[model samples]
Target: MTIVLIGYMASGKTSVGKILAQKLNYKFIDLDDFIEEKEHATVKDIFKNKGEIYFRKVETQYLNELLALSNDNIVLSLGGGAPCFGNNMNEVLDSSTATSVYLKGSVPFLSNKLIKKKIKRPLIAHIETVEQMTEFVGKHLFERIPFYSKAEKHVLIDNKSKPEIAEAIIAQLF
Candidate 1:
């Protein structure tokens, strides 16, 4: 079945999704990357030039396109905010033989992961202080948890390795 990973930013959805897909012998796709390729622009670029509203519209459109070709063995990593828009989450749940898995993490853990990775995450990169990072992650996670709770399964990823996290999610799916 399609394993749809959903969670807040820096929650390791993409990382775990890759490992799960490899272990399960399924195709792996990051919804945001798919949208970026289709639109010929990076997500940051889309949010920069056309604004967030326009970007979200295109995101919904792209999601619909992806879901149309449904199958049982695909793995998808959704955007952090994808579930908050319209009925996207419901549609994703209803469409394919999909399993929605929420990778739960503590606010402190998420803050540390994001800071340590030094990735170009447009959202939280602006926070230069520990207090700001904690507050930002805490508030964001709090706001997104309601949406994330809609998932079919919840896996806490406090300090797990990638393979362990992926295996945990896989075990829950079966």
Candidate 2:
């Protein structure tokens, strides 16, 4: 079965996913990277040139394509907003072979982790201060939890190492 990691940015989806895939001997795929390869453009470029609406459509399209694959023992790490847009959440939920896992983290923890890499994140790139980052994360999480909470399993990531988090996820799945 496919294991899909869903969570907000800096929730260790990619890092934990790599470890999880390694332990499970599964192939790992980051959905954003998949989109970049398919579109021949960075997600940042797509958002800059075509706008968010266009990018969201492409994200949904590619997500559908990935989910349609019959490959098993595959681990997919989704973008932060992947589940919140369109009917993507439902698509993930409806997939019989896909197991969705939410890498849940507190707003304070996420904000602390994201602050160092804020410039890399287009959505929160313009956020100026830690206070702003914290506030933004709090509000974003409030809006996103409804979608994220639909996951089949959740692994709390606060103060956990990447490997520990991955093991927790593995425990949940197995």
Candidate 3:
């Protein structure tokens, strides 16, 4: 079975997913990294060069490719916006052996975490302050929750270590 982690930026999907996969003895795949390897460009460059529409199209294509693999026993960390576009959410939800988990984090938690890593993120790189980051997370999260909430499981990630969050997910999965 595949464990799919979905969430907004800074929600710890990639970090916790890595730990979760380790504990479960499963392979770990970060979708964005896979895309970068496949396309030979960073996601930011994909957005800049070909634009978001093209990126979203390729994102769905890659998502489908990953999901269709047989007996992979993988933990997949999706891009923050992956499920929010096109029919991607439905595709994930319909996958017979995939369990989709949303790493639910509050705006404050996300804002605080994102502030420290904004330079690595193209979307919020220009955010000037914590207040602005908070505002951006709040609004963007509101828009994405409909897609995120469709996940089979939801794990609250506030005030938790990565291992603790991984444990919570493991508990939920079993």
Off by over 4 Å in 1: none
**How far out, in Å, is residue 113 in model 3?**
0.8
* Top TM-score model: 3
Best by lDDT: 3
Model 1 per-residue lDDT at 72: 48
Clashing pairs in 3: none
TM-score of 1: 0.94
Residues 127-172, candidate 1, lDDT per residue (tens digit)?
Answer: 7876788888888888888889989999999989989999998789
Return the lDDT, model 3, position 34: 95
Give the TM-score ranking, best first: 3, 2, 1
Clashes of each: 0, 0, 0
lDDT of 2 at 164: 95
State the lDDT of candidate 3 residue by residue for 1-174, as single tens digits.
Answer: 999999999899999999999999999999999999999999989999999999999999999999997579999999899999999999999999899999999999999999999998878999999999999999999999999999999999999999999999999999
Return whichever of 1 and 2 wins on TM-score: 2
Residue 56 miss distance in model 3 (angstroms): 0.6
Model 1 scores a C-alpha lDDT of 0.86
TM-score of each: 0.94, 0.96, 0.97
Off by over 4 Å in 2: none
